[model samples]
Target chain A: MKVIVIGGDGYCGWATALHLSNQGYDVGILDNLSRRYWDSKLGVDTLTPIAPIQKRIKRWQELTGKTIDLFVGDITDYSFLSQTLRQFEPEAIVHFGEQRSAPYSMIDREHAVFTQVNNVVGTLNILYAMKEDFPEAHLVKLGTMGEYGTPNIDIEEGYITIEHNGRKDTLPYPKQPGSFYHLSKVHDSHNIHFACKIWGLRATDLNQGVVYGVLTEETGMDEMLINRLDYDGVFGTALNRFCIQAAIGHPLTVYGKGGQTRGFLDIRDTVRCIDIAIKNPAEEGKFRVFNQFTELFSIKDLAEMVQKAGQAIGLKVEIDNLDNPRVELDEHYFNAKNTKLLDLGLQPHYLSDSLLDSLLNFAEKYKGRVDKEQILPTVSWHRK
Target chain B: MKVIVIGGDGYCGWATALHLSNQGYDVGILDNLSRRYWDSKLGVDTLTPIAPIQKRIKRWQELTGKTIDLFVGDITDYSFLSQTLRQFEPEAIVHFGEQRSAPYSMIDREHAVFTQVNNVVGTLNILYAMKEDFPEAHLVKLGTMGEYGTPNIDIEEGYITIEHNGRKDTLPYPKQPGSFYHLSKVHDSHNIHFACKIWGLRATDLNQGVVYGVLTEETGMDEMLINRLDYDGVFGTALNRFCIQAAIGHPLTVYGKGGQTRGFLDIRDTVRCIDIAIKNPAEEGKFRVFNQFTELFSIKDLAEMVQKAGQAIGLKVEIDNLDNPRVELDEHYFNAKNTKLLDLGLQPHYLSDSLLDSLLNFAEKYKGRVDKEQILPTVSWHRK
Candidate 1:
């Protein structure tokens, strides 16, 4: 089987590409390297030192004797995307190429507009390219759990059977996304569903949860092939940020009541879930969805867990409460169904089991590179 | 009261702008004149001969002795839109500015990309401008009923309370839009909802049905003030196209079995609905929605009604069933809730009552202007 990771230079994409290549599938990496560009633009860097894309790929090839093809261009450019797809002609395409930070989107009007237009138009171009040339290829698009917000009802995978006024029909789940970046994902899901229905295209939308930890099996094989670990306020997840704070003497900044709950998974499981989705493709003319997460945690719970782990390793960690920068429910009912991926032969990874080895140790080693100014939230959801 | 009608040169916008101006409100029209440009690009003309927007505004002032300010600029340009809004200082902004044709959107990849980007970006710029400069202004955005692709269950207004798994919550209605154009409207709805939630902004999304007539009370005041009527396959509605075909002695083209049912109203009612929404603005931090149609009809029923009306007016009419160019259900249950506007004192004009005076007679008078070459569908939903 042939697969292309469209954001193969980024964290999850790099790990997934390396894992798939190690699994003996012909792999190709297609990225514009915008993830690095954004880091430079924002004056931030990944907590872990990582090599360039070419160097990472070269080191992997030397160690594993596998050649991963590379295509460097923007997906929003139709001619470039279509030409790249035609040149590679893969059976499956994993799309993680999007402006992914919610804070970056909410910074101002210009950033918000750029985030939406870039994400929505990029996905639209890929859909059109698939309909025109690669109708048979399967699209494994990465969506986010943020698209669901904090609805009162139990969130289904991608759809729900709504019994409205005594009539029942399964419909796309109602989305109340909280940010412009998440709203873009909701738009992409709708667009992809329409394309599948009309043009007989196949797609599997992986509505993934917050990904934590840094090392995947392939990335851990060599330091030169290490994955990027973001610890800044803009791009970092709660668990990762907390672990980093514990490693140094910085306080774990908990926004508001810290009762906001969400689903989460390790980076290793993200790669595995992508593999499982690609192995079991949706039928032609079908749009499938899976909630890709193994466990759930509230911000308060993760803070306490990180505190205990740091104390066990002889580190003093304090938790501080601050006003929430985001306009979201501090406490809400959030029981989302994530059994679809589990049913499809995905052995999960738990954050509690690997906290010290996967996160804390790495953060302690990279304490010199941690920029303390990036630890506090800088972007507020409310307009000034 | 101060009002700014965006895209006020287009069909619905022109009618609504004149109606508001005549009702003792200070009205300003901000348009890019892209509607006329698109007609030239497609090599199609409106069935009704209309004067230029400047001439139309001038004639309205002459007849009513009321001035409507004109501001020519694209809403997609943030700086241009923000400057115009600042200059106008509108208390209410009526947004009817969008690429409104489904077939035009599906012409090809370029068209699809253009439609979504134009509509979404333009609407985003408005929301941001509202947040930055005019937080107190009310936004009366023109959305389409087509945003809710015919579902099996009865469609609620913009939200439905679903009883699922012993839980209940009123959420935004699930959307299954059929085309890129409709999807763009759905995207705007989501974006607007988010803006209202986070910024304490007020917005009312009018999910309007197909608007069928060429003249409103204000537009019929003089020959120069006449509203444009589209009769080409790319821009024409079914009832308008049927009336035009009857006038020219051409066959009424009904796609497939013509069982595709939809909601519809008169062009007069469209202007009236905008007035009603503006009078009763949504509260700050609230996103209100109203189903803005009065009646429903299947395609076959509309064609048959045109046939009967044409015979009574001494014209021979024939109905022709053509293969559907767009991929949609020919027969589907389409019971939608539209009582919100009625409860708000909207006196609707029925198609049966106005078929002769409102549509057929006008089409007959303009029969010489019909372009036969533009009658049949030029775009297909399926990619070749």
Candidate 2:
């Protein structure tokens, strides 16, 4: 089956693209390379050295004897997106094209607006393109668990059955996103659901959790094919940041009380989740949702795990509690059901000390590139 | 109190601006005049001959000695919106600026993108502007009842308490919006709710129903100040279309089984509800929602009413059930709670034969201007 990965130059997108190519799917990538441009704008570079899309695709072709086609343009541009869709005509489209950073989105009004327009408009364009050209294409959209925003109840996979006043009906799980970035995902989910309802367009919204680890099997193939590792205050996940902090002898910064628990998964697991979703497409006119995470941990839990991992490596690691920059519950119940993907034969990879050590080793290799100033939160969610 | 009426040249926006201005609030209108542009693009016009913004505002000023400031620019443009907000420094911003037509939204892929981008981006710009410049401003956003697409079970006012697995929590009511236009409203509600939560911004999402009626006390002041009455396939509501059909001696065109029930209110009630939302503002960081409609009616009920009203005026009106161009439940149970607005002291103008006669009389006055060819459903929700 033919598949197109939008935003294929970004970290997860690139990893997923390579993985799908390795799986012998006819893979193609369409990206505007905006993430790289954003890194340039923020004066931050990925800790991991990553090749250009052209070189990365060429390397993958040489390494695996698989040619992944590349189309570079903004998905927000309908003409370009439709043209790309017409040319590729994939049976499935994996959408990872979005401004995917809460901190980056909350940096300022400009950043906030840019995040909304880029993410929401880009997703809407994809829906429109599918309706107009490839109505049969299944959209595997990467939503975030952040879209659920640490609700008190156990998070259902994609929807919840509500018995209101003796009448029972199931509906999309109520969203309470924490930031402009996550809010955009919620918006995308709504639009995609509506489009599916009206147009019979098949879509699966993957409510993915925080992804950690640097080396996917495809990325570990070569030095040049490595995925970008963002260890900045903006784009980096807490676990990844904690591991890097330990490697660089910086105190692991925990926001507030560090009781903000969240679902998490390895980068490899994200790839596998996407693969499972693609392989098991949503039925026609169905907007399926799967909670894509292998484990749940709080900031303190992650910090302690990193510290333990550091101790094993003969390194001293300390933890510091900082005032929370984002407005969220410091402590909350976060038990999300992830049985759908598991039921679909997903072998979970829980975070382990061995995994932490590998990530620390990778961070140690790039210790010189770790900018300490970018490690602490700079943008405050509260306006002064 | 200074109030900025975004999209103030449109139907509900114009009347609300005038009503607020009449009530002695300093009112300003910020519109891109996109609705006018859309009418031109669609080769249709409002059944009622409406004057341009300049003339309308001038007429209001001339008659009532109240000046409403006008800012002619797109709200999607952040700079323009911020500039308007800074100048106005509004205590309340009434947001009615959106592509409000479902049929127009479903016309084509381009139309769908335009509607989503115009509505969602415009609302996002307003949120960011408020966060940046007027954090204390009470945003009175005109959400639609269509956001709660005819669902089984009782639709609570903006939220529902779900008792799941022996635990109960109140969440924003599960939305099943029917159209791209309504879906954009759902997206706005999510984004606005997030903005209020994180930024301590105060907002009230008025989930207004389909507004009918051509004349408000403010709009009835002068011909130039008259609100635009859309009676076309794309922009007109079913009741208004039926009234026009009666006025022009045409069939009361119903779609399919015509059992699609929906909440509705008079244009006068819409203006009054906006006033109530502004007067009793949502608290800081609270995203309060009110289902703003006076009554509920099905398509067949509206058609029958129009037929009876036509009979009262000695005009023989025929009823015809055309194939449903939209993919929606032709028959569904719809029970929605709307007591919040009533509790806020919104004395609703319930649909009565007298009210129907008034609207029919107004339609008869512009019967010559009514484009009979534009009355039927032109845009099919089903993709061909």
Candidate 3:
């Protein structure tokens, strides 16, 4: 089957591309390579000197004897994306192309505007392209767990059947994302769902949590195939940041009271979830949603897990509670339903000592590149 | 109190501006007059030849001795909007600054993109300007009833309390707007709600239905104060189109089965709802929402009402069920909760014979200008 991966560069995107390609699918990666420019702007690089997409693809081809085509373009540009989609005619499109950094979105107006525009416009273009050109294709869009926010009640997968005033209507659970970045994801969900209903387009929104333990089985083979581990404030995920901090013997920086709990998944499970979604596409006019997470841990718990793992590997690690920068409920209720992925045969990789050790070992190799300055929170959620 | 009405040159915007200014508030209107450009582009003008904003403001001043400050600027420009907000320090802001028509959005790719960027960016600028300058101000934004595309169950106001699998949570109702324009509103609601929560800004989102009446209490005083009554295929509201067709002795063009039921209200009630929202400010850190409408009617029912009212006024009006240009459910059930605004004291003007006669009389004056071609549907919602 033909498959196109939008944003095929970030942590989960690259891994997803390689995994699908390894599985003998005609996989293609579409990315603007803007993340590298953003990393440059912030004066921070990934933990390792990440290879270019060409190099990574070449390495994957050599390792797996498979070819994954590459389309370096912006999804927000409809003409470009439309032409690309028309030519490719993929049966499935995995959309991961979006600005996914909370700190960067809060940095300045330009970043905030860019985040909103890039994420929203890109999604719009994709929906329009599919509706106009390839109506039969399945769209597997990556939504974030943050879209659900920290509600006072247990969160269902993508939707919850609401009973109000003796009447009932299932709603996409009320979303209150933490940052503008997360809010953009919420917008993506809204737009995609609307488009699906209006045009009978199929969509699967995987509301995944912050993924760590970078690299799927395919990515783990070649060093170049390994996921791009961005440890900077702008492009890094929480678990990766924690591991890098622990590996460098720097204090694990936990924001505020560190009671902010969140669901998390390994990079492997993210790919598995995507692959499952591709295999089990939603019906036309249906927007299938899955809260793509496996485990839950507070900031304190994750930091301690990293600390313990680092100590086991003979690295001195301390815990530091920094001022909470983002305006969010530090302590709130968070129980999300994630049965859809499991029902689709996803055997989740739990965060155990071995998982922590694997990430620490991986982080140790890139300890010298950790930018301590970027580790500290720079943008406050409440501009007050 | 200094109040700013953004997009105060469009149909509802100008009516709202005149309504608020007449209420003795220091009101200012900020608009780029893009709607006129769009109207000109479509080779159609409003049913009534509306005066320019400057002249309208002048006439408003002449009649009531209440001058409305006019800023011919786009709210999409953050610098311009921020500066305006800082200078005005508005206590309340009524945001009608969006491309309000659905068919216009579905016309083609260009229209779709323009609508998305114009609406979303304009909303973002309003939010940022409020955050940067008038943080204490209340924002009354206009969302559409189309945002909640017909679902299987009864619709709640803005949120629904859900009980799923022995657990319960209140979530924003799942929005599945029919057109790109409506989808943009859903996205804006999410983004604006996030802003309100994060910045502790007060905002009220009025999810209103189609507005019909052309005469506002303020507009009735002078021709210059007349809100633009668009009868063109692209920009015309359903009722206005039917009125123009009736006045010109043409068939009332209905789409599909004409059973597309929706909630609707008068232009006066729309203005009143805005007034109520402005009077009752949302709490800081609260993104309050209210269903803003008075009554519901199916397309068939509305057509019959228009036809009957036309006969009562001595005009021969026939109902024509043209091929459904729009891709929506022609037959569906719609039961929406709109008690919030009624409780807030909105005395609605029902579609009585006298009221219909008033509309017929008003349309009679502009009967010569009605192009029969512009009264029918042109844009197909089905993507090519």
lDDT measured at residue A106 in model 3 versus the true structure, 0 to 100: 86
| Candidate 1 chain A, poorest ten consecutive residues by summed lDDT | A349-358
Q: What is the TM-score of each candidate against the true structure?
A: 0.99, 0.98, 0.96
Which regions in candidate 1 have their CA more than 4 angstroms from the true location?
A: none
True contacts kept of each: 0.84, 0.70, 0.52
- If you superpose only chain B onto the true chain B, what TM-score does each candidate give? 0.99, 0.99, 0.98
- Encode model 3's per-residue lDDT on B322-354: one tens digit a residue: 999887889986899998888878898876777
Best by DockQ: 1
DockQ scores of the candidates: 0.86, 0.71, 0.56
Model 3 pairs in collision: A162-B162, A325-A381, A327-A381
Best by TM-score: 1
What are the per-residue Cα lDDT tens digits for candidate 2 across A61-104? 89989999999999988899999899998999999999899999
Q: lDDT of each model, Cα atoms only?
A: 0.92, 0.90, 0.85
lDDT per residue (tens digit) for residues A119-221 in model 3:
9889888988888878999999999998988877888888766665665666666777878888888888887887787688999999989888875688778
Give per-residue CA lDDT, model 2, range B1-384, as digits (tens): 999999899999999999999999999999999999989988999998899999999999899888999999999888888987898789999999999999998887778777887887888888888877899999999998888887678998888887777667788888888888888899899989988988889999999888899899989988888888888889988898899889989998899989999898999999999999999999999999999989999999999999999999999999999999998998998899999988889898899999999989999998999878888888988867
